[model samples]
Target: MSKPGKLIQELNRMVNEQFATPEFHHFLTLPLNRDRARFFVTQSAHYIKNRRDSWGYVQGAAPLDVKAIIWKHEEDELVNDPRCNSDHYTLTVKTGESLGLKREEIDGSEPFPAGRAAFYAWLHLAKDRPWLEAFAASAILERRNNGKIVRGGSLSDRIGKKWVAELGFKWDEMPDMKIHRDADEAHSDLMEMIFNRHVKSASDEDAALRGARESLEIDRAFRGALADAMEKIS
Candidate 1:
């Protein structure tokens, strides 16, 4: 098998393994109330903003063709997507509406200290690391969200199911997550395209693995911190 194919299999394994971590396990198992749900969606809007910043930095450091691909990916994120006619951040705010969150509430949401630190860690990878590593750091997050890749379901699917079971929300009322569950399937294909085209040497594979590993670690810490904060809410 080719190096990129092997690398992709390893990355997929890494993503699935995350659900078993203490952080992911705790976060996913948390029982949801309306207040906790409100807090989660509000905080998630900040995460969406961080993704925009990191992807812009990654775009600036990438090769022209890669930059073009990132730009096209950002179109659905930064501008209007025909799928929802809302940029991703706005879509997140809209998601909050289902939890009784007003626009100002989401707009004023702040990240926990650990979550803020994790966002900065991702920024460093995107802005200062090698372009492929930076690309992998961002792409791996989408790969984690891609339902086709993650067995059972992606993060959004799991959380959305919680809303239905615990908070009485129907799947259709949570369009933002449903949209991402589909969108990431396509976005993750873009990640594989980059790897197949660029990951030719052992060092290239190392860079991708490094990014994927570190990003997932930071993601664990971030999710753990959010769970801690949510626990304090009720």
Candidate 2:
């Protein structure tokens, strides 16, 4: 049974390791034409919405203090983020618009079958698991996006670079990606605080690790599925 600090290190290591997995490698390495890029952006809006839904469930299941923190986190994602002067979802739509996607196109898009399954899986974790586990499940995603933790510039940073190099868009043009690159870092720090406070025993660490592991597996499948779908587009 590892100490909580050691467990946190292990979890951060696990997230960094995900970038080396076949699913992430394949998804990130795939070529991006305008059509493929547009497809990805549209699909990403669905992913963003799923985050909102999953977080709502987590908030409901968490302790009151944790719930308050989660609510504050939601303000940036669901209500209004002062940094972008828009909610995260609206920022996603604007990002798609930069890629020539219509608002209706993004709004009407559905997650791929695997993405749908992943969303439901996360919802289950957030809604049905113990509060610590549920909170870890949702927090792990933000941890994966935290550049300080992920070491390889985080998911959005890597993907945004692809857009700049492959699609010829400047960094400033992708407001959502830019904002999340910073936002998730702060969010993950908040999550870490919770683990520091609550993950006292091996049992606590185990539950949180279970949730994080399952969430990452689902994330890998969802990214792979997105790549497979994009490959078929054109």
Candidate 3:
């Protein structure tokens, strides 16, 4: 059940390469900070917020079935998943309270310019492209986050470890990194299955490749911004 014109294999290759790039390291470095792990945690929250916005745009243009799959994925993101009892944003805020950051700080800090631009660019791509292609961009973003799929560890897991070891955070108490490390595993696998099933013809495949490439380009920049902001904040 692939698309009218899909190229899942090539897109998969491109997306796989994107996962191995240096951008993810740059993005997650903030969480490695001993003095400012909380800032990184908050910044990560912003990153996930951007992800939600991009996913929504993709959902708006995807096929009904794809939309449904993405909607289920959003259950772990926008809505509550029974496994966690909270959405991704709420999870971040919970981490904030633990770090002694005020809720106003979590909810009120506007996204940095770079993060904002990268997000809107992704949203534009998601909104304007063909459904599979658009959906591919958002999927590619998760694939980047799915450290399990990425080879080392997901950014969530690395950040989680950093919060405890490098930052001297309470090893047992960091919920944001703890929960996502497990949840994104399931999310990424589900997305991989979705891609395998839906991408059919060459044209559709090309669109998927386009989505992966464009999103990766922006993601590199997005992650770079996250790292930069973390450094400055620290």
Q: Estimate each model's TM-score.
A: 0.98, 0.97, 0.85
lDDT of 3 at 112: 75
Model 1, stretches more than 4 Å misplaced?
A: none
Tens-digit per-residue lDDT, 1-234, candidate 3 = 435223444544555576456886566554455435566666667778878877888788777887888889887788887877888788778787877887788887777788778878988888888777788777776665676556667666766776777757674467777787777767767556766677556776677778878988998887777777777764
Query: Considering lDDT, where higher is better, how would the candidates rank from best to worst?
Result: 1, 2, 3
Score each candidate by Cα lDDT: 0.90, 0.89, 0.72
Quote the positional error of residue 173 for candidate 1 in Å. 2.1
Regarding TM-score, does 1 or 2 come out ahead? 1
**At residue 224, what lDDT does model 1 achieve?**
92
Question: Which window of ten consecutive residues has the lowest lDDT sum in model 3?
Answer: 1-10
Highest TM-score model number: 1
Report clash pairs, candidate 3: 3-200, 5-201, 5-204, 6-200, 6-201, 6-205, 7-205, 147-153, 147-154
The TM-score, computed over Cα atoms with residue i paired to residue i, of candidate 3 is 0.85
Each prediction's RMSD over C-alphas, in Å, is 0.9, 1.3, 3.1
Query: How much RMSD separates candidate 1 from the native structure?
Result: 0.9
**Candidate 3, residue 226: how far the Cα is off, in Å:** 1.9
Clashing residue pairs for model 2:
none
- Against the correct fold, how does model 2 do in TM-score? 0.97
